[model samples]
Target: MKINRNFDNLVPSYLFAEIASRTAAYVKAHPDNRLIRMGIGDVTLPLPPIAVEALRRGADELGVKETFKGYPEYEGYDFVREAVAGYYRSFGVTVAADEVFISDGAKSDTGNIGDIFGADNTVLVTDPVYPVYVDANIMAGRKIVYAPCLKENDFLAMPDKSLSPDMIYLCSPNNPTGAAYSAEQLRAWVDYANEHDAVILYDAAYEAFITDGSPRSIFAIEGARTCAIEFCSLSKTAGFTGTRCGYTVIPKELVRDGHSLRDLWYRRQATKFNGVSYPVQCAAAAVFSEEGLRQVHENLAYYQENARVISAALDEMGIYYTGGKNSPYIWLECPNGLGSWEFFDLLLNEAQVVGTPGEGFGAQGEGYLRLTSFNSRENTVEAVQRIKKLLSSSV
Candidate 1:
């Protein structure tokens, strides 16, 4: 009957909650100000036309008694899973259909996957990490260690042989920082995890945004299948944020303490989850179709262009930043020595622009800020111009 007291250790507010609170307050005070939000990585584009058509067709099938479906398979529909497998192959990575488990989204999978491991296992996460990685382990009362992602390392935390943690969480095209790890960098981690008998929870939610040569999957590195479980979402990939369909890849080769982790995950889902709806899975499968891919990339390019506008503005302002080339985020240091929240307030008050304060992410994020390219192109262009004008005048 006792509640998990470990929850007491978590911060009082989730990062986005605090940001929303402040934004609401600002809007109330400056009711006439037209605020442009370049925060919260939520996609602004509509779902791809092909996916929309697929969803409609799937729904139509359900209306007919012959094609009606009860609860879906816990792992996902075979067509969706197989489509995901084929999608991986497009990037030169091998993924079997059975290895893929459909879920609500990567956020849910990243937080819930910890359930498979023992509570006694130590967790290693990067500083300035996506908060879910840190908060989830804390809820389980596990000892958590951080690998500092300082500027010296280009914000990519490398493996350290001196430490041996049972579980490691990694995000590429990382949230908050927008830095991605190269295949060589990921290879080092795969080797480290295998040698130490640890497991890596790799989040590849933004992989579709990566146009550079960085790997689209961790399995692109050899030995990763033995030590890594990858989580991916179509939320950012194909604008399925609201529809909520994503997948997890658990290689059959990953076994720890004589237990097959893949089998354990399958059991976990079968027990506690009813699986994504048939129609949503149908739409997700279409994301792998040729026409679906073509439409999805067109939306991605629009966001990429927004990122370019923001980053180019930063360049003109001589602001040091990363991302916006292969990522939809622009992570920049607060200008004029302003602290994270200080810059947040200044930007909102001066330019009517809203961004997430980096301090909310973690200690290493204190003097930074995150701007997203998820808004409309018009809004993004206007936001950058306003930001440039404000900063230029101040300078």
Candidate 2:
């Protein structure tokens, strides 16, 4: 039997995997090096106390016969969905509880959602995007197109009316570039999708990090409900990276080819998926509670401070960059005209620090690098100083 030969077209190794391999080799050779890793967006903070307590309560409930749960609903529990709905309302966006589907995380939903659409549909994604968006579509053997997110546009790629794609992927406060789109800019994309009869897959995983007045949810834009499906995660928001819980919102009004996209997603999940753990959903629901929000924001504030420190150092170095204002990432141009991987190596060897090479994201990411604020405050401070000294020495 023949395999899905499309797999043959993918790159030999994933971006992060290659980074790990190189770092591993370095550590093996230099045993005394104290490496400070600022790569990979994984959070280093502990889960919020409120969520942890909720998790314990939910788990305790399972011990008694009355509260013992068998299998969970594919679309998640009513309480969790209601909490998510209330969260939308707080931000002045209305969302019905019935429309939310609880999942493992945004990463899973984003990669798996493509299963509902036709294989023949064309996919469009921004260049220098999170690799999952592009790689997943490649596995489906779909014809993929790239919208260049160049330096001139501040890394925000706009819709090109000339190209017609059946599906589009957009991440605000974008992954590698850390640039977000304004409401007026997003309106253009929503209108374009409606006109082209195309569906927009919007990733709002980093929405909570937004400090400015940018729209936190695509539903904040008018006409979006008719064309967009939003995926959000607690991984970055509430430090649920290891906890594994998030939600996907599909509007009932989003009908394509005369089929309710929401209904289609429901059917897809019910058939192939078992749903998130009851304890995790309970914890996720608490994330929207008053106390829960306060605790999570405390952790977020710490990361924001780390971002501020890094940004200040870059300012001193006179580096060209974006983000670290409303985002937890700093996307900077490699110093002294160094290429992406070249800078990655320089930081690793000279500064004993690590960051993602922008080239790993896509072609447009060349000569760029991405740094995260997910590490401890002390580590963040030290890493920036190390970077500063290394760059200064070269000059």
Q: Model 2 — TM-score against the truth? A: 0.99
How high is each candidate's TM-score?
0.99, 0.99
Best by lDDT: 2
Model 1 agreement with the true structure over 1-395: per-residue lDDT tens digits = 99999999999999889889989999999899999999789999999988998999999999999999999999999999999999999989999999999999999999999889999999999988899999998999999998988878888889987899999999998987989999899999999999999999999999999988998899999999999999999999999999999999999999999999999999999998999998899999999988889999999999999999899889988999888877898899998899999999999889999999888888988889999999998999999999999988987
Mark the regions of model 2 whose C-alpha exceeds 4 Å error after superposition: none
The TM-score that candidate 1 achieves is: 0.99
Cα lDDT listed for each candidate: 0.93, 0.94
Task: Per model, state how many residue pairs clash.
Answer: 0, 0
Tens digit per residue, CA lDDT, model 2, 1-395: 99998889788899999999989989998999999999999999999998999999999999889999979999999999999999999999999999999999999999999989999999999999999998898899999999999989999999997899999999997897889999999999999999999999999999998988999999999999999999999999999999999999999999999899999999999998999999999999999999999999999999999999999999999999998987789999998999999999999988889999999999999999999999999999999999998988999
RMSD of each: 0.8, 0.7
